[model samples]
Target: MNSRQIKLTVSYLSILLISCVSGTHYLFSVYSISIQERLNFSSVQINTIGSACNYGVFLGKPVLGYFVDNYGARRVCFAASILIFAGFSCLALTYEKIFPTSFLLCAFYLFWTGVASSGGAVSFLTTTAKNFSSNRGTAISIPLALLGLSAFIYSQINMHFFDDTFHFLLFIAFTAGLCMSFGSLFLVVIPAPQHVSDTIESGSNDSISRDDQRIEQTPLLNKNNSNTINRDQIELDIGGWQLLRNKDAISMILILVFFAGTGLMYINNVGIIIESLYHASATPHSDAKIKNLLGFHVSLISICSCIGRILIGPLSDIAKNYFDLSRICSLLFAGVWLFCGNLLALLWVHDIDQLWIVSTCIGLGFGVLYGVAPTTCSEYFGSRHFGFNWLVFKSLNLM
Candidate 1:
């Protein structure tokens, strides 16, 4: 391969590796029971720990996105490695009884895991979105698919390789740490070729069809410094209060908050749901069997989610490019899928055997929503401010 091809290859690989490890929070359901039994913790405390991780993921993003957008991703990624190692290591030590089992402390440790994951994700995703503006859908979807599969990868490793929760936690700690550390070397935004930049500038502002531009009505000014708006590519970058004030941006944020909140509610609590169903079932099963079933569901969710993320991107691109359909159409489809999942969970899925239907639907819906949301944000607000803009939507999931 030529030098440009080599750099692109290395950059994509590095981001994929980083994204794969960044989503350790998704493994919570797989390990939640083990942590509870080993730590002698109450259910509330366990839930608190899980909530801490989820909160960190959302809350940390805006700050991380700001830094990544302003200062570049390498330093943010390196810092993420340290936080991941420290947070997971401390949790592992606590699980092993090497450290005192304090509920608050445990929650605190897991919070950092969320923060690190957010930082790493923003770093790589920002790079990808900025680097591949023309093919953002396919390029961003690949790393996102790996990220969604993170739980599956780790869960399978735990089931086959490690018997102890301590070892499992340690495995995650070192593996995620090393991946982020290594990725920092090559995960960077490449400057688009001048010709490509010129084309994008002319095409985005001038050639956009009325139907294709669903989000922004007119160009927005940079509230902080009016001169910062790129005159060459009008409407390509808008940040701060101005973007937030736009009706389109507000609508997208609300939609994301609803979708992401529902998805996270199910994702974070699927373990408890599985255990409850197991207990209610007339057919008796061993604790080990129940544990295995939970792991299976987690893996199933991860697999379906990965598929959805990967599938939705190209499909959305096709819908927009060929059919001239709005990208928002994909969002509506995902919303309907999510609604069906919830409806199924409510009316049916009383039995353990029937749970997979809900898991599949929920996972696929969740993944598709996330996959399309970021791409939509970039298209609407412009890729230059995408790091901060997308994270703003992501962080609103906490609401």
Candidate 2:
């Protein structure tokens, strides 16, 4: 194919693969209650496992980034997909069998799944950054918007089909296997740029005289300058331990950890909060039915989240270029929205209508962070080392 065709094909496939991975989060949310009931665990225990899984995501990306940089994106992408498949298989088996397993195995299942899927977001972002230097913001935004579409679709399916614990686990395993298998097969390597040289000569006599004089008089000087330039160009290959030495990187990591920890906490618990409020306020007979309606409330949040992701990236880009504000401002706005969303949930949300309003607001606000943070890190650190740098930042979010 020609250059334009190649670019279009890569963009489409990358977005499709990335969206599949992002949709896993939605799947997990939908299955959370069912899994907890089947596993015979308390809400606290399930939340702890969920937190550990998020932490696993924080740890997995940087290790994958190192491999991605050394080997190639295609290898990392394929490997991650395989891991995801294996993880889901294990989850299915673990749930299906009547084994009296310890908490550690449960944590392991959650952790590995998180790790396996961690590469999905950044890998796609890196692919977009490499492919579209001019419209990187728009490219990133489009896939992210598609990822949000998963929420909309999955919410409906989850509401309708995830009626029993066994069916839910089967669905998760089947979908994960199918998506990973197809995505791995279709994953493409972006070709390196090809260069063509042009030959032109002007003032040949004068150039020859200058070259001759320089060669004779400054051989040592030229060698020294060349050595210095080479040394300057040499890059650092530090892992997470070494990266923590840099204060700026450390600070960024801390910020991401706090943001992700609280942000996910809010996202995960919103439905539960709404259900509790509805049950407490509703008539006695209506309480059980209202509790079941939590599924609808969670779905609304997912839809709002999708909307936010679709809008935030492009909006941030425009604000950065036109208003000449820092991109961090957009992230800060997202944070504010999240904080406000949680506060609203705690203070307000008495009925179903109030729940929808609050959930949508929170969903939109959370989307800002999801959409903007990865792109912001890519912008801050040069894209050449983005795999390493952004992985570090992403790991923090996992925590």
Candidate 3:
């Protein structure tokens, strides 16, 4: 392969590693009860801590996205390494009572963890979306899928290798930090070769560089991509107030807020829901059994979500190319799943075992919704300002 191809390959793999480490926040359930029981925190405090982490995840991203867009992902990854390591280390110390136990203090640390998560995510995703314009959906989905699987990976490690919650937190800190540090070395934007005609048509300066003219003469842009949508849509560079004024952008924000909010509620509190159901059923299972079930459900959700992320990307590509359908079809399908999942959770889930059904639906729905969203934004708003636009779109989850 050529040097540019090699760079793309290395960058893709590096981003995958960073993504796997970035999602430690998804493992909140694995350690939430331990923090509560050992530190004497109430349910209200526990929920608040979860909220703090989530708020950091979404709210911190706009700034991080802006930096990633302007300064490149390397600096963002390095900064994320520091934030995640410090955040998790502080939480571990508090859990062990090495630091005085304050719920607010723990919440503060967890918030940074969330911010760190967003930093890693925004960096990798922005790089991917910018670099892989031809098959952006398939390209973005791999890392996104791995990110969904991160909670499962960590939970299994904790279950097998660490008995203490303190050690588990430390493990996440070091592993995630080191991965981001490593990824900083390779995560970079490889600019898509712009065709001069397209650039001129988009109202660029009439002047064209020698390199641009040479690339335009090559067959690079002539490759058969029957499965991809219109290239003109992909070249849109609109941003700032123009993007905000867009009716499509406004509609996306509303839809994502509703769907993402529902998914986050279930994701953040699935552990509590499982506990309540177990208790209500009057089952005589041991605490150990309950813990095992919790891990099982978390893993199950992660697995299903991973599958959904992988599936939706290529499916949407196929739909657009083969059926002349819009990406909104995928979103509608995800909405159906969310509606059914929530309905089932409310009306049908009484036993812990039956909870897997709800988990399956929600996981798949959440995965597809998120998986389709970034590419949709890039297609609709343009990858030129994707980092800022995508993150700003996601920040609506705060509502």
Candidate 4:
């Protein structure tokens, strides 16, 4: 392979590995019951950590993505690896009762994981999208899909490697740190060549419709051509806060909030959902049965999510390019699908046995929501300022 192609390959592989760490938030479901019992915390208390982690992720992303834009991916990723180690280490210490303030220390763990995810994810997504401008959807889908699988990866690790929950925390800290540190080294954001702008301006007039011209709207690339002209065709018309004021931007932020909120509810409560639904008490409920069921449910969600992320991105890209689909329209369809999934979860949840179907639907829907966001953001706001703009728009999820 040529040097640029090799760099792109390394970019993809690095993002995939680090993306594994980004989904550490999902592990709350698998490990929560164990953490609750050992730490003597209430269900509400443990669930709060999940919420805290979610909150921290959104809070950190805007800054982290912007930093990746202005500074560089490597420096932020290095810090991210350290945060993962420190966060998990603190969780290990807190569980051992070594920390004086247990709740505060636990909150720190949540923040650490949250911050780490943003750090890793921003770099991964931005790098991949830039490297493969032609197949932007397919490019990002690889990492995003693997990120969804991260929970499953860690669940397997927890089950096989450590009998004790505390030790598993340490393992997570070490493994995540090592992966992030190493992965960061190879993440290089190849700059868009300077002549790309002149090429797009000259080539785009025929394809852009009248309405698109009036609004200064442009497709993500030269849709009629085989090779992409993303950098040149970018919407320099609006960016930063100005783009946020646009209707598309506002709508996207709201949709993501709803989408992410729905997923978070199910994910944070998976342990309780299983216990209450299946009646998995310590005595009456078989521990083996509980573990098996819990792991199974997490895996089902992870697999569906992974597959959905892989599929929806490229599919949406095709519809947008080939069919002249509006970016917002494509997203709304995904949002509708997500809403339908949640509706089905409410309707069919007569028993725990039915929960898998519900989780599957939710996973697919969430995959669509997430996969669309960055690609859409890059298309809508322009990749030139994508990292900061995307992080800003995505902060609505935090709200």
Clashes of each: 0, 1, 0, 0
Candidate 3 error regions (>4 Å): 193-234
My TM-score estimates for the predictions, one after another, are 0.91, 0.79, 0.92, 0.89
Worst 10 residues of 1 by lDDT: 225-234
Q: What is the C-alpha lDDT of each candidate?
A: 0.84, 0.62, 0.85, 0.77
lDDT of 3 by residue, 1-399 (tens): 988899999999999999998888788988887898898899999999999999889999888989998999899989999999999999999999999899999999999999999999999999998788766788888899999999999989888888889999999999999999999999988854456335544433332343345433333234564322235322568788898899999989888988888888888898888888888887885767767877888887888889999899988887766565778788888888888899999899878879999889999998899888898998888877898999898887799
Measured on C-alpha atoms, candidate 1 has an lDDT of 0.84
Tens digit per residue, CA lDDT, model 2, 1-399: 888567658655854765655556544555565566667877777777666567666788788777666665666666666666666666666676654444567667777777766666556666665554434566677777666566566556656766555555556556654665565454454543432001002213234344544433432212334312111122233444656786656766776676656667766665556556665774564533643566676676667777777788777777765565666777777777777777876788566567676767677777777777666666655556667778878765754
25 Cα displacement, candidate 1 (Å): 0.7
Ranking by lDDT: 3, 1, 4, 2
TM-score ranking from best candidate downward: 3, 1, 4, 2
lDDT of 4 by residue, 212-237 (tens): 45334345555575344343353454
lDDT of 2 at 326: 62
Q: Considering lDDT, which of the candidate structures 3 and 4 is the better prediction for this target? A: 3
Q: Write the per-residue lDDT of candidate 1 for residues 112-162, one digit (tens) a residue.
A: 999999999999889888777545677788888899999999999988888
TM-score of predicted structure 1: 0.91
Residue 30's lDDT in candidate 2: 57
Candidate with better TM-score, 2 vs 4: 4
